[model samples]
Target: MSLLRAGIVGCGAIFPMHAASVAASGAARLVAVCDPDANKLESASQLYGCAGYDRLEEMLERERLDVLHLCTPHYLHPPQAILAAGCGIHVLTEKPMCIASADGEAMIEACRRHGVQLGVIFQNRYNPGARLIREALDDGSLGAIRGARCSVLWSRSDEYYAESGWRGTWSKEGGGVLINQSIHTLDLMRWFMDAEVSRVEAQLANRRHPGIEVEDTAEGLIAFDNGVNALFYVTTAYSHDAPVEIELHGEKGTAKLTADQAVVTYQDGTVISRDRLPQDAMDYGGGAKSYWGVSHFKQIQDFYRSVSRGEAPVIDGREALKTSRMIEAIYRAGRTREPVLL
Candidate 1:
């Protein structure tokens, strides 16, 4: 098959991973990159041997791209995605897809109208352990899932937030722990449970980070459509960062998965345990790290495949809207100090 031509926007911290993936993937080639910062664009251009532009319009005009990767700030996601879709370019956006559900819907609608594919980066779903667990739940190995818990206790210092102007702002990064850091685990939670949240009650605060306008910690109770309840706790203020852990309780047994391990215990004395392989680059300018270095690559490859085969991406724009809705509901719940129905 002919390689798909791809362009990347916002050559920030995550751009290298995407560039590397594109360079290594058989299905796509990194043709152009755009960033407002000249230094970032030059660096990416040097490293990836691709043309770089300081503006999206220039890049779009110069390159014949099959896919456009939006790696910009949280707020730029919707507009950039829509722009790409309008230009007849398929889009692969970073997670949290968009800050607002309305924005997500607009992007999806624009893509649909333009006949372009829209995919979001939820690479954790591509993990072997995640797949195995999902398959097991689908086959009723754990029976009816009744309850679940998701905890993402990670740390990001003040310096981390200071690295980018949009890191901790509500207008830029959207929200703190929930929208920026916890969205991955939150997406995983929704994926694993295979249910939409019916309602949520959340408490959020800027506990540790002093200058940030958004929450550094968030604790919430989520009720899913299947009558399963879940408790979500996310914080970037922990003194010692810990791995995210998820526990799912079912009618017949319970399954527990830490950042690196998965364990299942059945009611009939059957116990299974396996090491959960990391499927994405977890380290984003931090001491904490993850193993899935090629996750973005996997996502891009899958997109190229989908385009070639005329199939849908794993995390399409519509599927991503659910995550955005859940996020908005959580923030609303925090503000109202009461449960918000989704």
Candidate 2:
């Protein structure tokens, strides 16, 4: 009924996006922030004019927050979210939800046990092009699914991994390209297929980034039970942060997605294209693109609505579990050099 008071943990690179989104949303306001890094916490407090704490537990104790937004590192997500849920604060975490499925399940259980909501931020779902494709499928205009191919050619240099100690390590940031850079694509693929992934065969390589523990590149194939199949190639060793592309093929039509643009072709060769959607201003200050315009804000508003209405978020913990499980499958397939059947 009223604006949800919020606190954010981890004032790192993605922290500003979440802070700004919550600040802009009519349904929420960021009242506090937390980070292990004192400098980051101080800077965020100065920027947002909010109280800052070094420990999340302290903030939870000191502030009567209605929501806790987690922009922390991969491995820290589960414990932090579970802690917040235990405090009766709903959680909205950035993806890939957590590094492991067990952590995700535990986080879900904690939230359920405390009677709070758990939401994951896969803001790509709010992208205009993605919404168009999902609408087509829901309306039966895309016909039955046939297959898909997703490509993420974004680049991450050696310095990118070296700059952060927690990143590029399996124990900390999880896997490389698939989990970090292209997880939204993976989620999109799962969303487009609209079915459980039955099998995965994958290969991983650390070609460009020197001394990185995880793969800078990965290639994988996924199969769904009803015979629909998809191929995925992702790498952070490319020339730049290029537009992500996905081609969706259905029985009677096809759709091609590039960033926030889409092109659809009917069985009779009639074509429709959406190439002129309003674009977010480019901010390459941190190398990677900030994100699609207003996606975080849109999702934040929706999550607040879900909390108020006793409904699940558009992308809840269970949906995020699918993405994590797929990433795990890819890694297992690569390590064993055999298809992992799920």
User: Pairing residues by index, what is the TM-score of model 1?
Assistant: 0.95
lDDT of each: 0.85, 0.88
In model 1, the Cα lDDT at residue 180 comes to 85
Residue 249 in candidate 1, Cα distance off native in Å: 0.6
Residue pairs in clash, model 1: 279-292, 280-292, 281-292
lDDT of 2 at 14: 88
User: What are the runs in model 1 whose C-alpha is more than 4 Å off?
Assistant: 276-290
Per-residue lDDT of model 1, residues 160-202, tens digit only: 9998899999898999999988898888889888887899999
Clashes of 2: 0
The per-prediction tally of clashing pairs is: 3, 0
Give lDDT: candidate 1, residue 143. 96
